[model samples]
Target: MSTELLTYLFVGVTFTLYIGIAIWSRAGSTSEYYVAGKGIHPIANGMATGADWMSAASFISMAGIISFVGRDGAVYLMGWTGGYVLLAMCLAPYLRKFGKFTVPDFVGERYYSQIARVVAVICVIFISFTYVAGQMRGVGIVFSRYLEVDIVSGVLIGMGIVFFYAVLGGMKGITYTQVAQYCVMIFAFMVPAIYISMLITGNPIPQLGFGSEVTGTGMSVLEKLDGLSAELGFAQYTDGSKSTIDVFFITMALMVGTAGLPHVIVRFFTTPTVRDARKSAGFALLFIAILYTTAPAVASFARINLLNTVSEASYKELPKWFSNWENSGLIAWVDKNEDGKIQYTAGKSFAGKPSFTDERGESGERLINNAPTEGVNELYVDRDIMVLANPEIAGLPGWVIALIAAGGLAAALSTAAGLLLVISTSVSHDLLKQNLAPNISDKQELLAARIAAGAAIVIAGLFGIYPPGFVAQVVAFAFGLAAASFFPAILMGIFYKRMNREGAVSGMIAGLAFTFAYIVYFKFVNPADNNPEHWWFGVSPEGIGTLGMIINFSVSFVICHLTAPPPQHIQDLVEEIRVPSSNNAAAPVEGGQTANA
Candidate 1:
């Protein structure tokens, strides 16, 4: 079959499966809608979390980021995977034991303040939507490029698939589907990576392949990459150009932000026991590592292969994928010397590198520009296209191409469902039913949850169509917001009994406002626009999220110390949430015996 037909077949089949799962497992009650009736198995929750965590960015964009950024890209691999360790160890079990449907519930009940819940809701919406927009955009790109659909229509289709299950099955239905998505996405990501690795380095393990010797060449892949990079004036492959302090802070911020994300935290609530939650987190990371470990290898291999193909070649003779990507505006090529050959060379470093001169001896730009180049030089490759372009880059079969398309959609949709579920429950269960109508019936709450989830999907879909920026950068924003506003509040509430509602609320506002302002100023206001001088404190907008988070923690703690202690009842509530007794382990509701010992 033609690649187009195969793409349609695979995508159609996957959609059918998701729809079928939704129909068969339709939610019947508020419990089912919100927490999958709080009956999800630990392993199942782990799988779902894996799917939810590995958005289109993870599956498609991560390797691309690594491809272009070189050494600094390790921060993502370290920060993202390392954060899971923190979640598994410090956050997941305790939160699951708290047994709330949403992250804000813990914040509100633990702080003994409804105001804290409101602040949490705001943070959740901001972080989740920011994250969701990237997923949607990823889906759109996959569809537009592979299946030949319009970008907007692709986003709508992805949104519709998520809406079906997210509204029909709620958390319960979405959970099982996400498990399936995890399987499909993982398989799709690893197969091409493994093949490419073996082809390039004669190594089977993608992670090790990164450092392994290139086939028929005695040099290690990293060494070769470093040599190639230096030839073009770029830094060595494994050594970073950014300061160590900046990289340290960026990694720390990502770790804290990952731990604080509402949708991820809420996954633990479905596990049956505290131990289960911990085990589930471990399982989730294990599954996630399958791709995370392989991603760097994919990036390295693709970079080498592209350079090998394009270097010293005429522009019109470029590979089909090159033109395809160039047409998409993700990859650009310029013939600086009019040599009919694309020359990629490292330009002079601004600090002290040699300045260039034209034929007339007038000073010229530091670099010759093009996608494929001759010596050490500057070359621009869009990181977002790395994964999607991998199958073709490696000359994989057409079926693999179609499978990747479906897999990318699966990754995006699974995360979208998870985020929409949290958005729905936060609104319907926590805000409307809890605050708006205490007497609301379970049936009415279920309907409300569905409506809220559907509405959230629509809003998220729109943002995907008109994405504010790159997938990884947008996702980093979500992480920063989560780290700043939610992480500190939750930690203080659980670990420090002296923490008051006023302190938590103040901290959240400070974190959220500061992070948002910083992003706007650096990313949009004054704008970096590819200029290095625009960064503040050597922190790009992506790294600034960490600064926002630190500011949040500092402000929250300072405010808490200045405030009076919580009232007796609130103190009792805090104590109750800490205890893991089975009787109190049931979902939180008014008039229930406090879980406090």
Candidate 2:
């Protein structure tokens, strides 16, 4: 079959499988909807968590960013992976032992204040929505290319499909679906990596292939890339351009942010025991490393392929993949010198990303409204397209290319569902039933959760259509928000029995406000001044969360000293969680409720 037909078949089949799983395993009660009835096995939960943790940002955008930014992109890999370890070690099992339905549940009861719960709910919504937006954008990118639809239409299709599964099945449906998604996503990712590795270096393993010598060239992949990049006025593939402090801060932000992310944290709550949470976390890391380890190799292969085919080449004679992406408005050529040859050198082809016009140029390339800049570079390629376009760029099999489309959708939709569930849980369970209504029945709350999820899907779809930045960059901001707001509060709540409601609430508000304002100022208000020269302490917006996290920890500590300690019962509960004894695990909270209840 043709690549086009194969793509449709793969996508259609996967969508059907997902919807079928969701319908068959749909939730029937609040317990099922919120925490999968706390019955998921460790290995399965780990696989599901892997799928949930690796969003569109991981599967689609990470490799793309690495391909473009080269060595500097190591921050994302380190931060996200290290953050998962922080979560698994410091947070997951304890939160599971705390026996709360959501992050807000833990916050409210631990602080002994409804107001704190409300604050946590606000943080959850902000963090989840910001993160979900990237997943939606990833969905739109995959659909726009393989499905031949505009981004708006692709987002609409994704929104509809996600709504059916997420709103209907809730956590129960999502958990099992994610297991399948993990399998599909990993297989899809590795297949192409293996193919390209064998084709380029006579090695089947992508990780090794990354460092192996190219088949004909005596130089290794990085050496060849360095030479080509030097010729094109770009930095070496192995050398980083970002300052050391900035890399440190960004890495710290991502690590702590992963620990604090509401959606990923909640996955542990679905497991049956504290030990199960730990086991699942381990399993997830193993599964996630499959793709994470291969990403550098995939990136190297793609960068080499891209440069070998297009740099300073004639536009008309260039491969079909170039025009295919050009027509999709992700890849544009200006023919600036009027020499009929494409220039793919360092620096921007224009002032910003291309603003494509409805009309095409004399050579049938997408016309951009942005005026061409004064440079040898005449190409503008969206970094997000690197992974999706990689298979075609390397002339991989039709089925392999089609499989990537499936994998991209699986990765994106899986995380979107998880994030949406967090939003729903926060609104229906935390905001309404926990604080406001307190008297609503389980059925009413379930209905509210579904309604909240449906509304969140629409809002998230809008963000996908009009994303603030590239997928990885937008996700980094979400991580920054999470790092600033939730990580400190949760850490102190667990470790410090003296932590008071006043301190926790104040710290969260201060940290979130500071980080959010910083990101908004640089990324939105004064994008022109977003360079390192104008950054505070040489920290970019992506890394500002580390500073915000310090502020949170400090503020909470000072406020705790100034205020009375948490009540005796709350202190006992904290001691009980830290003891880690299953026999005495059920610590009592206010209203005679057991922590494990």
Candidate 3:
């Protein structure tokens, strides 16, 4: 079959499976909708968690970022994986024991204040929307290039699919649907990686192939990539350009942010018991490792394929995938020296994003009005397109390319469903039912949840059509927000019995405001000043969340000490959650382990 037909087949089959799961597993009550009735098996929930955590950022854009940034990209791998460990070890079992439907539920009850719930709700919505924007835009990117549709249409289609399943099944449907998605995502991601690895290095294992020598060449893949990079005025593949402090900060921010992400945290609530939650966390780490370990290899392979194909190649003679991406507007060329060749040197191709005219140049290249920057580089390839285009770049089979399309969509949509569900819960359960209309029925609350989900979908669709930055970058900002706002509050509420509502609320507000303002100023208000030179204390916008988190902890700690302690009952509850009882010999212990005390 043609690649197009195969793409339609794979994507159609997967979509059908997702919708089928949603229909079959549709929630019948508020408990089911919010936490899948807390009946999911640990292993199944673990798979779902992997699917939820590995959004477009992990599945589609992570390797791409690594391919381009060289050494700097390791921060994502370290931060995200480490953060999950923190979440599972430090928070998951305790939160599951709390038995709340949402993070706001835990916050409100723990703090003994409705106002605190509202603040948590606000933070959840803000962080979720920001993260979902990346997932939706990733959906658009896949559909735009693979299905040959505009980004707006792609996003609308994605929103419709998500709306159907997410509204109907809620957490129950999303959880099962995500199980299938995890299978498809991991398989699709690995197939291409394995194929390229074997083709390039004669090794079947991607992780091993990353270090193996190139087929019939004396040098290793990394050596070849490093030499090629040096020849083109770029840094070695093993070398990173970011400062040590910046890397540390970004990693720290991502780690804590991951720990505090509402969507990921909610997965723990679905497990039947605290023990199950801890078991699922272990399962999820095993599943997540499959992709995370292979990402670096995929990055090196893609960079090698890309450089080998386009370095100083004639525009007309370039592969069809090059033109395909060009037509999709993800790749732009200007032939700066009138050489009619595509150059791959470092530095920006222009002062800003390409402002393409409707006209074609002499070599049939799309004309860009953007002024050329001081660089010999003549190509502008979107990093988001790197992984999606990798299979095509290496001339893999049509089915492999089509599978990539399906996998990319699966990754984006799974996380989108998870994020939207939390957003819906925030509005319907936290705001309308808890705060606004305390007398509402369960049925009424369910209806409100569905409506809130629909509205959130439309808003997320708009963000998808008009993303603020690259998938990874936007997600980083979301992580930073979560780290700054929720991490400190939850950590204190669990660990510090004296923490009051006033302190928790104040810390969240301050952390969120500081992080959001910094990101906005650097990412939106002054894109020109987003570099290290203009950063405060040499922390880039991406790493600013770590500092924000510190500010939150400090503020919360001081205010918590100054304010009156929480109610004695609340303090007793906190102690109960952390301390294991003798009757329960295998009770869930602190840091996600079991012990008889």
Indicate which candidate wins on lDDT. 2
Q: Between prediction 1 and prediction 3, which has the larger TM-score?
A: 3
Candidate 3 residue pairs that clash: none
lDDT of 3 by residue, 1-597 (tens): 999999999999999999999999999999999999989999999999999999999998999999998889999999999999999899988888777789998898889889999999999999999999999999999998889998899999999999999999999999999999999999999999999999999999999999899998889998998999999988898998888999999999999999999999999999877778889999999999999999999999999999999999987787888777876678777777878788879776543444544324322243435446567888787889888999999999999999999999999999999999999999999999989999999999999999999999999999999999999999999999999999999998888889999899999999999999999998899899988999998999998999999999989889888999887777877887787433434433333443222
Would you list the clashing residue pairs of candidate 2? none
Q: Alpha carbon lDDT of residue 362, candidate 2?
A: 25
Model 3, poorest ten-residue lDDT window?
A: 357-366
- Least accurate 10 contiguous residues by lDDT in model 1: 348-357
Candidate 1 lDDT over 1-597, as tens digits, reads 987799899889988988888888788988777777767787888899999988887887778878877888888778888887888788777777766778988888777777888888888889899999999999888887787676898899888888888899888888889888898898888888888888899888889888899998799988888888777666777877777767877787788888998888888877766767777898898899888888888889988887677677776666666665544445555445667676665552211112433332312223334122343333345568788888887788889888888888899899888888899899988888778887999999999989999899999989999998878878878888887888888877767778888888998899899888878776777664534465667776666778877787788778888989877766655565566554434534334643221
Please identify model 2 stretches exceeding 4 Å from their true place.
351-370, 582-585
Better of 1 and 2 by lDDT: 2
Tens digits of per-residue lDDT, candidate 2, 455-539, equal 9999999999999999999999999999999999999989989999999999999999999999999999999999999999999
List runs of model 1 lying over 4 Å from the truth: 346-380, 528-536, 576-591, 594-597
Candidate 3 segments whose C-alpha is farther than 4 A from its true place: 351-373, 581-597
Native-to-model Cα distance after best TM-score fit, residue 261 in candidate 1, in Å: 0.6
Cα lDDT computed for each candidate against the true fold: 0.79, 0.91, 0.90
Sort the predicted structures by TM-score, highest score first.
Answer: 2, 3, 1
